[model samples]
Target: MHDPKKLEEGFGDLANEQQLVKEQDHTRNFDGDEKEDSRIGTNQPMEQNQDEQSRQQQTTAVTSKPKNKRIATLDAFRGLTVVLMILVDDAGLAYPRIDHSPWNGCTLADFVMPFFLFIVGVAIALALKRIPKVDAAVRKIILRTLKLFFWGLVLQGGYSHAPSNLSYGVDMKFIRWCGILQRIALVYMIVALIETFTTKLRPTTISPGFFSIFPAYKWQWLGGFISFLIYMVTIFTLYVPDWSFVEHHSDGSKRYTVKCGMRGHFGPACNAVGYVDRQVWGVNHLYSQPVWSRLKACTYSSPATGPLREDAPTWCRAPFEPEGLLSSISAILSGTIGIHYGHILIHFKGHTERLKHWVSMGLGLIILAIILHLTDAIPINKQLYSFSYVCFTAGAAGIVFSGFYILIDIWGLRKPFLFLEWIGMNAMLVFVMAAQGIFAAFINGWYYEDPDNNLVNWILQHVFIDVWKSERVGTLLYVIFAEIVFWAVVSGILHKLRIYWKL
Candidate 1:
């Protein structure tokens, strides 16, 4: 509905076009003893050559739009990432079939989050493109970014406690540590600052008398490269036998607590860091989401005759907390990689009109992902958010974005995945609702069972999940479908109400 490009151009035109340019150097160095100036009498044959050279430069100066063009493709790219996230996340009931986001190994599921983050970077870059860094605007940007970060942290930490309002006397120990919202908020703050001073979406080339630059200048793949390198170095260093922190442990022994509890089976492990993560690795360790120990015992086995070594009952703040600051570095890098891929589409601003370009970007990212996977330098683990993880995931996200653009923008087909479009348009709202337990609470009270009864089982029985014989692939899809429908109806209602929950 908004012609953002026109608005950008209108804003850019406020300053004199002459002031926008510099007295640019046309060549490296040229000596004019008037020999470089005229030379007509000395070499009559050179006249045509000089004219041709002038014409060539003029041609270079006269910029043209890329062969194909579409901005709607960006919309599709944005929508596609949101759709896949819902698909993978809601499908958790179907373990092994769709349970891809555990730590260590990566799958098709991990890409969507990074891709979404990357898109955020791209969009922010675009939004800040034309604005000059006036002191007021700079302050506004900083404050706004800080606000987003604080709010994100709030969202992530919300459900851990029941009280709606937080008071001054609330215990710090009661507050849950970092989470999805907190990470998003922190990363956005970091990214916004980076983009603000760095000039995120602007390009480098100057088409004499024209205002344009090479599209690749937009921050995307390049940023991924840098973030990946930094993360890889950290991971490699973390595992080093004589790393800086190796000496921090009490004993000379490498034996570390793989799982931690005062009386539980805590013992030496290969790495102290791993020991910490393993202990805190339970779902219940996460705020509000109760640590679901004895799951196997409750459903299929004896009711706790003994504790299994790998999956045992333990406090979540175990020595092995995976979401530690060190590990989160990897996750943040994953987000950065996604941002880079988003830039790939962004840089093709002029060329998007052409169908082939969009297709190429989509396919190219897929190929790149494969290459990164084979190398294994960029592992796809969601929990660890390894470098390879970011690479492959970002690439996959890019391909999805491209395909959506081709169908929706290139072919002008808008209705096929209106489901995705609706969800995409109001993604943040959905993310908050879904992650903050609003959806889960509503379902538990209505579609699902009450608090006293079995949690997962009741949801499986009464919800749209009933179509399936079990909580496998079919069940997951059913939930995803219902959620999408829920979101779609909500989006429509918002449209009718003319209310946008703008952050």
Candidate 2:
């Protein structure tokens, strides 16, 4: 088997090479200062103090190898997020907790997408330090950005009409303009540009007797803050449009739609976010799976009777994607938070300091989320990409990332989750394949169709569901197990061969 170090050459080299450059720069600064001090004929005590400082800086500079190396925790975190994304996307409707919240709250499913974007932010920040040439780097970023957008369109943008008629691809009415990967691409481009110009990740020598509060990427912090402010202002003011929904009377006579505000508007069609999507993309272009409506109906006596009691009003049937255009602004802010963590990882040397910074970031964001929620400034609505939603999820991500870092990097307990590192390494490929039905298609071709139709169902029905007498629990376990095995085999093979798919 190839060494893991050889496989991580891309990210590791950036970190390692930058550490050397930083050390060289620090040495030059110290020596230059020492020579100037000697020429000035400073007192003997001052000379001794300068020499002591230089020695200390050199020692600190040389302690870079371990600190600068690739963080296993980050890769593991990415891998974990990828796996959960695949799971939820593949079979989340069976479980409400794994599915997205109906409207105003978040679920475990919502975290996966934001986490992926956050990891992208972390990666771009680290990658920028290695690619110093602006032109080459910008070109690469642009190309990758375009590719991600194109792939998203290819995978998710097919017309709703079948090719039996000639109106399929030609109709713009059925085309979905925004989707998961598309949103990710947009967020990455925005955050990457900001980090490239505004943020610096190299460690700086602290002056004697001066404790610094800001990390190397303090400019990034400012940028993120500005973005948050813009997001909030838009949410509060611009979102609440005075659009009306047309209502039809029992006699079939139509009346101008009722105009609603933020206070009354709630679900897919009524809310400001959904209204924007409807105006831009039309209802046909939005996500059609109205899970909340169906769940609401299940509680009633009828399964397939009148339309499932919708969470939204009668005007809207199609659900608006959480990854829609309006919410993408907050998505960028979430990614910015991730970039902040990457800065912390590279700049802080002490384990305690790093841990404290991570905890503080998480707590601060959580507190801000609470304040926004309490004031009703912006409710924690995933559909709206509300300010509180971004804060809460980003804060949770920080706490989770910190915990993984401590467990894997600080304590050296990394071996158990190395499989996740492989998944993380090829996370995008796995995700694209899973999302595009490539994995399902491959599995279906080989697996048998038995008592429950497909092999997975057959296995579940025979092994678990039939015995347990609970289709939900059995099917859930089967899907989870199958997803694990699918990714494990794919990731394991790629890991063994050192073959990674990167854009």
Candidate 3:
């Protein structure tokens, strides 16, 4: 007799538990059809560099693993992240304010990467159980890592402004060399390799019926803690060196720039990193408006220094440099924290209600992150991808996962979020499309421009202003609506046509 009411108890034993989980493993069903359609390198090798490599190799693509069979919730979450990515990414360039902050400050759009990375970790945990052979897995891992790294370079290439000549524009060679997907690729390979070698020691066979591999999830938790601590240590220890900065106005005293802290002027969160990144990462180098405070630093000056004493320039302040690789440490911990949540999800097995479990933990994490932030123990900086960011973001992701799981899985209310699911299904394609020169260069050339002249601005100024219905939130809402419509249509079309994409 088994307790049908209790989910985990349905399994008779470890093998039975594996069988139960297998039944729910949606990834298996996707293997033959969608996998091939995407033309992902499942067990083949590919060239290391897109630009340099002339030789072609075959290998498997490490596409996303459906967390479980028929796990619509996971798919939905992935789609949700993609949708957010597009909106934040594709929105009419609002200049410095709308774009990502460089170092410490976060905006409405900053959570997007953390969400995507967390999903990557979540899917990896589930997929590790299903790899057919170790050799094939290794091949897939290398190819995928290279592909991601290459893509990251492409993003950096398009955006980097550090040129050898530095005359009228930027030089592509020394542009920091990495981006978001590149980091994800590195972490994914590392985690997969770790799983491969360690799990091999046990040699537990995962028959189609079921399989069981007991991993101490404590590792997951510890990894998050370690990453957070190490990141804080690094941040506090290392001071960013500055070689370029324009001087202040007539006042031989310093000028203040906004930062991510409570007193916005003291830190460079709002200005320095954000301005520099926006300047460097755009199609135009320093002239790209908004974060165009070229030569701004990321630190607040001392009152005594007057910002522009004979010793230093008057306009000194901290710089904003979000998307700085250093901040990625916070982003990495987001994945690590997410891994712990996955571990806990498996560990709890029963007792806690799913959504409540996720929600409560999320709230707790938010509080903790805020507290840590106040202590300056772990600053919450999106630019630095600080641990505070990890705590808040991971908590948010966990709650989201819980809510969707309960609604779609437990409550039996699974409807296709086909709109999001479509992009989710072919995430690689969607992102590649986003970065490719052919699309963005051509399309955005026509649509976006004069960030001051965006439709959101137009609507709010013309219609809302005339009607005396002025609300800044409405501007944000209008933008959000536009984003939703864009993703819904695009993703829906892809989903309906069964057109999946890969790299």
Candidate 4:
């Protein structure tokens, strides 16, 4: 046992020194290659090592940055449009002021269609930002267009009657062809194709100092103006001869003849819009209950729908689709205007610049609309889709969109409008389910007593109407609760689950 403890301590010190030397070597050559060298353990080319480190740093920077997202303002505006549509469709009967105008004037409901079309135009601009393959884009667009047309046929083509009847079928011989969705389909197709073909013009290529605010979208504006000219010329020049149609009441069928051999007439009776639809789609295919029926000239009560007046004109009962061919041409201009606004969103980065442009364009449109309408140059008419109506509605839509952008995007106040944003994100789904009454019709099918005593009726009678003791107030509340809030919740859940129904 002579000095055994000292020998063990000496061995431990040697091991510790070796370990520290290895650690220092590893630290010095941290960016070494996979291959090891006997002399230095591992070593890499300095250039390769620098490149790898640069790549890692770039990846980290990219991961740290926030992702670009969809504009919340657009979705919110669309949601607002859907909300208005539901309110009008469900509660318009109780509140006639919010209902569509009988003729020649705009009401709250009258703005709904233009707002919708304007949104479509804006969306088209955003969606078709980069259409590398024209054929593929066209194919996709055509598919969507067909789908829209199909749904329009199913929902508005007399296939499904909700709350009133459980039956679901359409008479092909007498099925209506034109409707809200059908018009939307046509507009989408036209505008999308226009956008697809005109994607060569880059926003940067056009100088901001150019006289035209929308310098890059000049071709689209030209197309829109051409369409307007076509509409104006046809509407004024087309000869609308005397037309006759059979009106079927509960009593029996009555034949009525409208007296008109006019070249220029925008009255409820004799118009080129109705004439073109009658000639192309036939009277049987037209909308049976036109908005013109609500006019004082046609009904006993003005604005509110009522019985036909004793001295009602012959065209009072005639079928006239509001979304006819001639008027749809004017509607294209609305979408074009919307695309111009959207282009501003794409070209401009600064919040102040975007707002200034949008507000200026909106005020200009509003002023033009006032002059045109007040001067009797072109009355603001929804049925005709008059130029003044397009100007006023599109201008209002731009203003509304800009306001939402300020509140939701610029100010970071999105949480308050998250419900609307969700609904807007899943707008087509809500349109089919709530606005179209497919879901209501399905629920109404499950009944307790007779068919009239369905779930929808029961809820209305007991829950809303009975509790309020006022039909109008109850009906409004029911629509708000049953349709708006209910659909908003459904949309929110779908959004959370990442389940979007797109067309």
- Number of clashing pairs per prediction, in order: 26, 2, 49, 0
lDDT of 3 by residue, 77-169 (tens): 776876666656544243334455543555546777787777766655554544445665567567767777776665543453221111122
Please write out the lDDT profile of model 2 over residues 1-503, one tens digit for every residue.
11233222122121122332343344554667546544444334444446766755655554332533667787788888877876776566456566676656677887887787777666665555443444545565677678888867766676422211223352465577787778888887887776655524544553332136354456766777776776666545554554543333487844334345563344445565666676777756766544444334232422211354534344344345666776786688888888777766666678887788778889988899888877876677777777788888889888988888888998999888876777777776777666455555444445444322555445667986787788777767766676665676787798677666755
Per-candidate TM-scores read 0.62, 0.75, 0.61, 0.87
Q: Rank the candidates by lDDT, best first.
A: 4, 2, 3, 1
Model 4 misplaced regions, further than 4 Å: 1-66
List candidate 3 segments past 4 Å from native: 1-68, 90-106, 159-170, 173-176, 201-215, 219-226, 239-321, 344-357, 434-440, 444-483
Ranking by TM-score: 4, 2, 1, 3
Error of 1 at 101 (Å): 3.9
Judged by whole-model lDDT over C-alpha atoms, candidate 2 comes out at 0.63
Residue 357 lDDT in candidate 4: 86
Q: On residues 18-129, what C-alpha lDDT tens digit does candidate 1 reach at each position? A: 1111111112113332243334324445455477666555444433323223244454455566556566666653543344433345545555557666565545444444
Q: Give residue 389's error in model 2 in angstroms.
A: 0.6
**Clash pairs detected, candidate 2:** 245-257, 246-257
In model 1, which regions exceed 4 Å deviation? 1-70, 134-137, 161-171, 204-226, 239-256, 259-324, 327-378, 442-460, 463-474
Give candidate 1's error at residue 167 in angstroms. Answer: 17
Clashing pairs in 4: none
- Residues forming the 10-long window of minimal summed lDDT in candidate 1: 7-16
